[model samples]
Target: MKTLRKYLSAEGLIKSIYSKFKKIQDPKNRTGKISLTDCLMSCFAIFSLKGLLQAEE
Candidate 1:
């Protein structure tokens, strides 16, 4: 959400990156491998949420 925007200048940055990776000739994308979206979301989750959780521990 909005929190991710701090790390990414804009939403288009994420989309453009995803699109570029999608066009690669790698077999992973064609098969059952993870997509660019998953990686991006994971990173976003970590960056946005980890700091808050660590403080509670």
Candidate 2:
């Protein structure tokens, strides 16, 4: 059996979570070029990777 954390951390599962997160209102004034979706994706990536995101796969 898969652990809950493993199930939740799956790539497909993360994509689904991102889709839902995209609909939420952004606090930023939508000023800079960086989009809210990009911001959220970055945050999620950093969080899911435990802040050790790297370039090489």
Give the top-scoring candidate (lDDT).
2
Question: Which digits, one per residue and each the tens of the lDDT, describe model 1 over residues 22-41?
Answer: 56565454445766556665
lDDT of 1: 0.60
Tell me the TM-score of model 1.
0.36
Clashes of each: 0, 0
- Report the lDDT tens digits of candidate 2 across residue range 1-57: 654564556766887878888898887668889878888888888766753566433
List per-prediction Cα lDDT, in the order shown: 0.60, 0.74
Give the least accurate 10-residue stretch of model 2, judged by summed lDDT: 48-57
Model 1 lowest lDDT segment of ten: 1-10
Which candidate has the top score in TM-score?
2
